[model samples]
Target: MSSTLQLVGMGVLAIIALWVLLQLVGIVFSIVSTIVSFLVSLLLLAIIAVLVYFAFTALT
Candidate 1:
């Protein structure tokens, strides 16, 4: 009976550990995704600035 209880406890602990690991991975991915999105936005703005500069030069 004790052995059965131990096995159940171990199984539950393993599940909890896996759940925590998955949560951590999700958080890391969220952070990386945000950073990538910000970088892409900045790149787009830079491109627009360059185009505007060229347009101004051509006009002058």
Candidate 2:
């Protein structure tokens, strides 16, 4: 009975550890995704601004 109880306790602890690790990894990935998205948007806006400026210059 003691051996069985110890096995069960170890299993529970392992599951909890895995859950915490996955949560941390998910959070890190989410932060990286947000940063990458912001950078991409900023780059696109800069490109569009340059195009508009040149277009207006041509018309003038």
Candidate 3:
């Protein structure tokens, strides 16, 4: 009986650990995705600015 209780306790602990690990993984992925998106946006804006600058120069 004691052994059965111990097994149940261990199972519960394992489940809790798995849940926490999954949450952490999700947060990390979200942060990485946000950073990547931000960088891409900044790069696109810079490219657009450069094009605009060249266009004005060509027109002048």
Candidate 4:
């Protein structure tokens, strides 16, 4: 009976560990996605600025 209890305890521990690892992985992915989105936004803004600059130059 004691051995059975030990096995159950180990299984529970393993599950908890896996859950924590998955949470960490999720957080890492989210952070990476955020950085990528921010970079894309910057690129878009730069493109807009360039277009506006060219337009003003042409007008002048």
Candidate 5:
């Protein structure tokens, strides 16, 4: 009966460890996604600025 109890405790510990690891990985991915989104927005703004500059020069 004591050996069975030991096995149950070990199983619970292993499950907790896996859960913590998955949570850490999720956090890292979220941060990377945010950075990529910001970079994309910056690129779009740069393109729009270039187009506007050319249009203004043509009108003059």
Candidate 6:
């Protein structure tokens, strides 16, 4: 009976550990995606600024 209880406890612990690991992975993925999106936005803004500057100079 004790052995059966021990087995059940171990299985529960394993499941909890897996859940925590998946949560951590999800958090990391979100952080990475956010950073990538920010960088892309910055790059696009810079390109637009440069184009506007060129257009203004051409007009002048």
Report the Cα RMSD per candidate.
1.0, 1.2, 1.0, 1.2, 1.4, 1.3
Candidate 6, residues 3-22: lDDT per residue as tens digits? Answer: 99999999999999999999
| lDDT tens per residue, model 3, 1-60 | 999999999999999999999999999999999999999999999999999999999999
Q: 33-57 in candidate 4: lDDT tens per residue?
A: 9999999999999999999999999
Candidate 2, run of 10 with poorest lDDT: 1-10
> How many clashing pairs per prediction, in order?
0, 0, 0, 0, 0, 0
Choose the strongest candidate by TM-score: 1
Worst 10 residues of 6 by lDDT: 1-10
The CA lDDT at 34 in model 6 is 100
lDDT of 6: 1.00
The 10 consecutive residues of candidate 5 with the worst lDDT sum are 12-21
Candidate 1: residue pairs that collide: none
Could you give candidate 2's per-residue lDDT for residues 1-60 as a string of tens digits? 999999999999999999999999999999999999999999999999999999999999
Q: Write down the TM-score for model 1.
A: 0.89
Off by over 4 Å in 6: none
Candidate 2 regions exceeding 4 Å error are none
- Tens digits of per-residue lDDT, candidate 5, 1-60, equal 999999999999999999999999999999999999999999999999999999999999
At residue 9, what lDDT does model 3 achieve?
100
lDDT of the structure predicted as candidate 3: 1.00
How high is each candidate's TM-score? 0.89, 0.84, 0.88, 0.84, 0.80, 0.83
lDDT values of the candidates? 1.00, 1.00, 1.00, 1.00, 0.99, 1.00
